[model samples]
Target: MSKGRGKMKKDTNIRIGTRGSALALWQANYISKSLSKLGVKSEIIIIKTLGDKLTRGVLSQNRNRGKSFFVKEIEDALLNYEIDIAVHSLKDVPPDMPDGLILAAVAKREDPSDAYISRKGNFLDHEKRKSIIGTSSPRRIAQLKHFYPEFSFMTLRGNVETRIRKMHELKLDGIVLAYAGVKRLGRKEEITKKIPISVILPAAGQGAIAVECRKKDRKVISILKELNDRRTSIAVEVERRVLTKLEGGCQVPVGVLARWRQDTLLVSAVIASLDGKEYLKEKSVMNQNNWKKKCDDLAELLLNRGGRAILKSIRK
Candidate 1:
């Protein structure tokens, strides 16, 4: 570990737990660099998971799937004290953390928007059923089908780069990926179209990087806290609280976007059917003084109205 230059200067080896995928490595390395700026050196520990090994089809399409698809392995490492901190894509994390784990810090959120990588055309061309598209998210699949039902949908498997390659080699069409991942991987140029949240709502915490560490370790938590972004954390908390209230733990097709402006938080959530036919959308503003309460109440409203039915439908 390199020594820091000032008050943070300390000889420390921070183990950063992350998936072994290129996109995951890129995110972990970025966080490592940020920690170094605060005078703490970080070593990235690659994690392997069932989700990464299975590249046969859409993860959401698997009935036996768990929200831990991208999380379980690293969570185990944290539970066993094999790593000091774990960096994750907030969208893929289950609403509930392991009993002893903590979501201690979150990086500043990214675009929180979806990006489309079309081969040589646009979604409209596909809307005409002239092309086929591929993806792995139920949220995207549902919305895409709703908007462009005539186009064919297929399962997308593998890591970010591999999926990109798969789309090109199979010559199917384009893929829908989070803009944050594509940008972080430095492949922004590959994006043929960047979808805005106004049209395509993103998965909860879509573009944010979350850090999970053992709840009892204050030293590691303190070290990681130096990199937390206040505004991003607040907004994501709003979105996450909504997920918690709705009991959306990965199998559910839920989406949300939260923004903070003038000391107020505006959050929107959408619950949809697996086949992209039915949906219930809601948005609300939270007073700066009682953000959590507002977020919880709004989430409750959605769940009671039609969210429960949607959940039951997806389960079958």
Candidate 2:
């Protein structure tokens, strides 16, 4: 048994499983440092996931791939007791977890906005007809279409640096990416524009880091609990519940943003078709005391308001 955080001491080091990507390593290191504050020691174990292996083409090109593409292998390692815990970008985690695994904690969130990066002048100054944006997210595609119907789009895939490098090499107009990723990679200056959440709701759990451990591993969970941010966890929970209720995955053209305002929780979500032809959005607020019910209500509201039809069309 290893020592937990704080005064609790264990004899062994906590093994953290993470994807080998730079961003993933950063997140894992962040967790390790956080644990160190409580006097716990940890080691990062790099693991390759399907998402890491399929770097040849855009993820959107594969309709058969599931939401767990980036996380299944890591979860498997946790279940097999090969690692003590798994660190993941919450956006990559599916709403449902494998039977024995649980989301132990959600770290404090980063900037949740999406950013526009372009080698050309400012993206907004470019001519719409000539401007070609790059992104693989259907959510971004749909929302951007709603705002700038004249713009054309192409699939852009790769890590934060790779996308930026490809953008310059290909001399493409611009690419959309999560601002959190850019900031994590110390490339904040590359942002040409920060798309507001009002215009483009972020993906569920977009800016949060999640820690996963086996449900039976009480010691690991206890150590992780010290690093959990309560507000971030609640916000992401509401967002993910809406996603789960909608039966949407990370690849779905669904966007959700949730926040705490005063004593209330506000949730906004959107569901759209691949072509951006049909879109449904809903926003609701409720006292934090009824967060779970509010999440359900918000999902029901969206579903009743054409979201169901749009989701069905997307699945087909």
Candidate 3:
């Protein structure tokens, strides 16, 4: 690594920009620690995002407030050269990055599955009681409604600990969260069930951490390259491509997961109505060498099978 002031000033530590949430801080610190092991020092700079500005009550009232709600500010900071690199929860990152910025690295993925947390051990046991579950994700609410129509759902948004606390304060039966966040935050024991992927296909890039930097900065790009996990990078690339082709975002009830099966890639996706009355799912397996083309093909298949109508209805 070049320490001299060519692209950057001499002896300057890499400035890592991130959101102010606990999980976001954990992600930023994780990257900083990884960089330290590589003989590169870093500093974490917390930035408040649009999503962070809204109260949980206000956010719950407006499910689709804005696109890239959690990342736009931090990305802007990176673009303005206020920070050298930005670490993001990959699921919160949009399918298309802002111009002149690139996704430089993807850390190894964690569980990438949704988890159910409740006072009791199983969500199914509450089916007879017509229990309510708390979660703000349209994808999760739609899929859960598909399986358990009798149960009601309420919108709840916050960090993992805050959500769990709200479950008690709000007197809700339980809540749904990404298992990766629970495990990463050391709250795995609170998980009632690690819902199977077959039950709930995760949002694209659910469990991964992304490192992004200015495309023109070779020094920062070179430093980030060492953190890339090829398998994780390729899988998320396929997942994000499917999302881009489908034109899905936080408001759209879309779920996609891709993983390597031996030497081939296995991908699955679903698009559903908010009421769970209409659902479309597609799966494909293709050689790793041609996953990108296969991703487009898979997306087209979904669009043809009523996905277009489903998303159109949601938009209205």
Whose TM-score is greatest here? 3
**Which is better, 1 or 2, measured by TM-score?**
2
Error of 2 at 101 (Å): 0.9
Error of 3 at 310 (Å): 0.5
What lDDT does each candidate get?
Answer: 0.80, 0.85, 0.87
For candidate 2, write residues 97-215 as lDDT tens digits. Answer: 88978999999999888998878657654645668888888889888887777778887787999899888888778999999999998999989888888778999999899999988
For candidate 1, write residues 47-155 as lDDT tens digits.
8977877656546666435568789989987777677789999887886788988888899888888998887756544434656888766778777767666767777
lDDT of 1 at 81: 69
Question: Of the candidates numbered 2 and 3, which has the greater TM-score value?
Answer: 3
Looking at model 2, the pairs that clash are 2-10, 3-9, 3-10
Name the 10 consecutive residues with the lowest summed lDDT in model 2: 1-10
Listing every candidate in turn, what is its Cα RMSD in Å to the true structure after a full C-alpha superposition?
4.4, 3.4, 3.1
TM-score of each: 0.91, 0.93, 0.94
lDDT assessment of candidate 3: 0.87
Give per-residue CA lDDT, model 3, range 1-316, as digits (tens). 2322223564899999999888999999999999999999889999999898876566434445445788899888887888889999999898888998999999999989999998556665554568989898889988888877788988788899989999989988899999999999999999998888877899999999999998988988888999999999999999999999999877678999998888788999999888787888899997777888899999999999999988887777
Cα deviation at 245, candidate 3, in Å, is 0.7
Give candidate 3's root-mean-square deviation (CA, Å).
3.1
Quote the positional error of residue 7 for candidate 1 in Å: 23
Higher-lDDT candidate among 2 and 3? 3
Q: Kindly give the stretch of ten consecutive residues in candidate 3 with the minimal lDDT sum.
A: 1-10
